[model samples]
Target: MEPGTARIAVDLLGGDDAPAVVVDGALRAMRADPDLHLLLVGPTEVADALIAALDPAERARITVRPVRSAVGMADHPSAARSESTVRAAVTAVRDGTADALVSAGATGATVTAAVLGLGRWPEIRQPALVATLPAVAGPVVLLDVGGSLEPRPATLARHAVLGAAYAAVAHSVVAPRVGLLSVGTEAGKGDRVRRATDPLLAVEPLPCGARYVGLVEGYDVALGARADVVVTDGFTGNVLLKAIEGAYAMAGGPPVGGGAPRAAALLGVAGTVVVCHGSARADDVASGIALAAHLWRRRATELVSALLDGDAATDRTDRSTDTEVRTS
Candidate 1:
């Protein structure tokens, strides 16, 4: 762990098993990193239970944000109840009481909470959920895992930029090769959206010395011989991620190098946020927490945001010149 203290706000009521599983994950994380601090946002009793289990010294590193019933009520709805806890967690980050956030709740709810609390980056209409898969070559960055299920071609192109910058900034990959996820490696091989996005990505300026490699097939994602970053719409990306995870499990275990990861980094937001699979186990949660700490220490979010701004500026200039020439 880095020397700087990283305070993470965890949503105690966000998961299916919640509170219990979250408590276990939090305790594990606290024990793993000495400099880690957790702000548990949920019902007071649940937070207290976790604190009581920890040693006095360890307990001191934990804080609690009590959440009760919200104003709206229909004999106590499930959505409203969970929203209260997630909102409180978001509030902690917004108030600077926490450096980052980790949650295993519904993807849509988490995205909504983060957007409302931290605010989205300028010109990032649809925030992307980026997942890193440990490939034979190295880690492969895949984006739009669950954020913008049916994004436009422009959004797919934007995500390519985001994924490339993230891979370079967060993972320190040099000259990342970006690839559009399609049915085949051919130029015009996928659905209508992929076919349209291919040309756009080919022309889009990527940050961190990144370059577009046209189109890549699903096999290229795990093999990682073709591209370092894979971009696709959320619907396809989500399904593909799960299928890969399932394949790893069926093969007895993930490859020695690494398999598909359960946690993802939320890009296009102002803060470092990680969202784990809703069915995440204790180990998954612990990993998610660690990822957030790493990102916060590296200042990944701010650096990636700067990269996107630079790319956007370049795109604007290129478009303006093209329009001028066509008219003149």
Candidate 2:
């Protein structure tokens, strides 16, 4: 949608019904965005079929990077083979052949490939996966959907900062109110991690004019009345996200605006990467490609990193002043 050319590398063998689903999604994405250029990473035949589906005018927008292997859903992320399609796509972004990448691969494999290829931001022990849900109020940003399953309390606090910055930078949320996901809205309502994370978020220096809103219930995630950005550990966030999707399914359809996205942006890594559900449909894959292009065009990754850098500098100065006062 943005007014720039976004060259995206797509992993064709990353989904449950890959190559076919991925090819269809890539075709749909190419037609939707005139300025979108695709670097298809998969078997040569699959890429050829997708490119052949387009007219001559549209065909110029496509390129192919042949990769045969893929990471299966059951494979350990650490076992991601060197020749996997997801890894090739990561290489394309790292090599500047593509501005971003989208994959319906195993979330762990995608994250692992992106981190190893592009490197993570400083002090980011674990990168987070952020999803934007179209809530009743507006868009609600949720982080750690499936990045680090057993994150420490400190990681949750750090993710609060990431979520807040992402809401403002990516979604244009003003003065984003951030919340720690818990059983209730009370100050100390969750398990050990939430209890520890609440105090940290209360004092953390959030970027993009954001503020902490204490604990928020599960309903707040869909309603968006209590917070614009919700933070939690990856395991809980992943489960909650899937449950919300299931609820929308049981109800006939999603609410007016949209539902929980099948695609999530991987934060803390250096490159712009989108990870879709392993069971993604063609439209879901298309949306993932579009999301990657949107982030690249907006320079969302760079801007978010800059916000974190500013916060870090301010924190260092504050600490220095405190030490000076004590010594004086």
Candidate 3:
């Protein structure tokens, strides 16, 4: 293997179009990165097909961890069993067999497995799933895409720090401007959660010299004119991300840079993990694997967590005052 090789464990049966899409994506990723190694976590037959397609020399870089069970999209997070493919991929990271993992499985199941197998960082009750969008102005890092569906004000505050650190460490964004997603830029324009979360973010000590830019609108997220890192509960972020992708599809193609990514990096977990959309295509799966390798090489997860430790007050979020916001 080349120096700094990133061995990524890929869940072969994770996506809506499994085995076939995954195999094709893995082939593309391996061909693109000379140093990339893969541990195919799925059925032996499925893994064999991929290996058979590769040249003998290239086949040496691949390993198979035969796991037949997979978590369906309709299944609950609790369905993440030790024998399942996603859980096995997490185990590879936890056991040092793989540097990171990529899964196009159920987001909740992947998050659950990562938390159960690798454990969460200190004081992170809800691990955020952060996605980077290549906007016209620059890269926009949005968090809680599908990790915590209904986070409290304190959780949103915590994720603000996570987004800031991720933007700086992973994307080389300096002094990231953080913002809470709201219906309007005006203060208190959103629901009770947005109004409550606004002040917490303003007072919260952000890492990487990040500053809270207060509330931002949907336009800010798409154009990247207002903030570098946008924080929101998982439900809204997830909905918004899909909507952006659909808009791009309707527009004939994405922008010159690219459109919304089908994959996101899971923060607050101890190991590097990339979660792709369940309906991910071959290119999306390839992008997810590439993201995993990139994160492992940068040691993004470790550095981001260390940044969190610098601010002792980040963990002091008083969740007792948190109330559920009505989405209706």
Candidate 4:
């Protein structure tokens, strides 16, 4: 829609419904994005079915990668499967055949494949999965949805930086307000990790003119009344995200703004990747593919990496100055 070519690799066998929903989603994405080219990664037959349904004009934008193997949601993520479709999708991004990849597979498998295939950004130990939720004020960026289940204090601080940069670049959030997700807005609330990370985030110089807003409650994530980016451990963040989605469903659809996204963008990886919920519907899969395209087009991944490098350099200079003064 933004008028650029975005070639995305889609895993045809990654979701609960396998090739059916994946194929349907691919069709929707292709139709919605005239400039989008998709490398359908799955069995030849499934890709053929999708090709048959597309018009000649749409068909010209498609290419099939023909992967026959996949590890289901129930399968072990660390299992020695050499030819999983998710892995092949990553390969496409790494090889420049695709600008990005979208998969509704096991989060663990997707994260592992991306890290192993594309590598991680420097100083990023535990890459995060970030989800953007529509809030009353604007879109709120929440991170560590499932990437690192139990990240350390430093990891949480790093995610704050990533989320701030992402919100500014991808969502146009200016002077983004960052907060640590906790039980209360108080300083010493929440678990040990949140407590430890609060001070670190307060001192960490965020890019894009962002500043820390201290600890914020779960309501802040939905209302956007306090922070634009909320950072937390993946275990807590994942649980909270699902709970919010369930609440939205029970209310008989989402609010006027928008609903919780069924997909998350993986940060700290060198390439653009999106992971949908494993039980994603066709629409969900389509949304994931679209998100991946948007990120690739915006060059969000590369821009965020550059910001982090600049921040790191500043820290080193400040530390060097302090050391010189202490010795003087």
lDDT scores for all predictions? 0.85, 0.87, 0.87, 0.87
RMSD of each: 4.4, 4.4, 6.4, 4.4
Please provide, for model 3 over 42-83, each residue's C-alpha lDDT reduced to its tens digit, 9 standing for 90 to 100. 878888999999998799999999864542322524234223
lDDT of 2 by residue, 226-313 (tens): 9999998889889999999999999988888988899999999999999999899999999999999999998999988877666665
Off by over 4 Å in 2: 68-83, 316-328
Q: Clash number for every model?
A: 0, 0, 0, 0
Question: What tens-digit string does per-residue lDDT give for candidate 1 at 1-328?
Answer: 6778999988877666676788899889999999999998877888899999999999889998877663233245434556777778788888899999998877788899999889999879999999999888889999989999999999998898899889988999998999998888878898899889999998887778788988988998888899999998999889999999999999999998777888899999888898988888888888889999889988999999988776655645576653333222
Report the lDDT tens digits of candidate 4 across residue range 92-195: 99999999999887788889999999999998999999999999899999998999988999989999989989999899899899999999998899888888
RMSD of 2: 4.4
Please give each candidate's TM-score.
0.92, 0.93, 0.91, 0.93
Clashing pairs in 3: none
RMSD in angstroms between candidate 3 and the native structure over all alpha carbons: 6.4
TM-score of 1: 0.92
Candidate 4: misplaced stretches above 4 Å?
68-83, 316-328
